[model samples]
Target: MTNNLLNENYWTTRYLNKSTAWDTGEVTFPIKQYLDQLDNKEINILIPGAGNGYEVIYAFEKGFKIIHILDISFLPLKQFEEACPDFPKAQIHHQNFFEHIGQYDLILEQTFFCSLPPILRSDYVKKMIELLKPNGKLVGVLFGIDFQKEGPPFGGQMKEYRKLFSKEFEIVKLEPCINSIPPRMGTELFFSLRKIQ
Candidate 1:
């Protein structure tokens, strides 16, 4: 799809039509394991393009008080609010990710990057640099293989990902994921990159 077509209206329409095949209905295993190991619950965390916000909810329930969720479409944010009523309403952001401003100690990525048009990949790297605190981390999974169809769920290989992110961030870990859900088993890469000072 064209960049213009991937706006709030398009995503909102997807939610309205219940067309979200990407919604796994729960936190995926790789991310869940990563969150489970985080020692600091007090760190500032952001989950942008957080559809239905399963990870946000999981973090909050685990005692992470300063977590935030952002989505371009208000529909998923509304659903997130309904699902997580006690999450601070002020922390729920309804805006474009590129327009968002905040410094996070940790930013959780799930399907957000692939959903963007490939043309925005550089912008995404720049924005991650802008959004992170010095030495901050960006962690989560990305598709490690190409798909046969056109995509809102676009895919890429580790070499391209490393090339794209390594200039501004230290590639702490970027490897084929061993813990993906069955359907995504051989297709995902779990990554952890730290912002360079």
Candidate 2:
């Protein structure tokens, strides 16, 4: 059932048809700012469901080497490789995030969570926990508001997120995104959660 929503063919078709409205064409300001403040350039990082991956490019430009870019579809990964020809080829994984394996010091979430169907939220959280090293952090933004329309960019709120992630992560910061882009302002939550042992 869930596979039907996130089926490889479905997302691949979306990219092929240019139906991904979630492709911002640029990294969101909140995520860029979050990366700007992180000084550790060598930490192992994973960006799952990384479509277009503007943020990953931004991080790489700033000297992060151990970054893994994972996505379910091959289209975006190919595009990413074209854009960053020198990016480590081995780190670009064309696979399902749930099936992929790795321990990372950080995982960056941009619009990935909202892209999944609502039913997979719990599983998403569990997979995130399993991928992080002890005390590893997950940082990024989430939609603070919901879209009434059916979505590849689904919507969620703090209450549901807290309940879903609290079992394996400490919600260090879950609050309104004061610096969200004008279109996303007031509708976004910037969060930084640390994995719990």
Candidate 3:
């Protein structure tokens, strides 16, 4: 499918039809552990394409007050608002990630990357670099294997990922995730990339 087909309407329809199999219902293990290890709750954080805002809620409840969640679609953001009314409404952004502005101390990647068309991978990296502060981090899991079928849950291998990201960021950690949830156990790589100065 074309990039245009994967726009707001595509995603919003998926949410409306309850076709979001990617919604894990709650924060996943890898992300939960990464957030758990953070000693500084005040660091500015962003979760782009944060459908349902699961991690957003989790981080807020844990005292990370400066966190932000962005999504192109409004339905899930609306749902998230109802679910976490205590969360500051201004911090919830209903905008396209590529058009988003602001620098973050850290950006959490969940299923967002793979959800985009492969053609946008480089643009995704560029936007990430643009959005991060100097020496800031982009950390999360990525699929470590390829899928046989076409995907919004598209997959990729480690070497290709390394080549794509290493040009602009320091690959702090890019290896098999030992803490992935059961179904994703051996298929994901837990990565931490620091924006190159």
Off by over 4 Å in 2: none
Q: How many collisions between residues are there in candidate 3?
A: 0
Q: For model 2, how does the per-residue alpha-carbon lDDT over 22-91 read when each residue is reduced to its tens digit?
A: 7889888998998899999999999999987898999999999999999999999999999999999998
RMSD of candidates 1 onward, in order: 0.9, 1.1, 0.9
> TM-score for all predictions?
0.98, 0.96, 0.98
lDDT string, candidate 3, 1-197, tens digits: 85653589989999999999889899999999999999999999999999899999999999999999999999999999999999998899999999999999999999999898788899999999999999999999999999998887889999999999999999999999999988888999999999999
Q: Could you give the candidate ranking by lDDT, starting with the highest? A: 3, 1, 2
- How many clashing residue pairs, candidate 2? 0
lDDT of 1 by residue, 46-67 (tens): 9999999999999999999999
Worst window of 10 by summed lDDT in candidate 1:
1-10
lDDT of 3 at 80: 98
lDDT of each: 0.93, 0.89, 0.94
Off by over 4 Å in 3: none
**Residue 107 CA displacement from its true place in model 3, Å:** 0.2
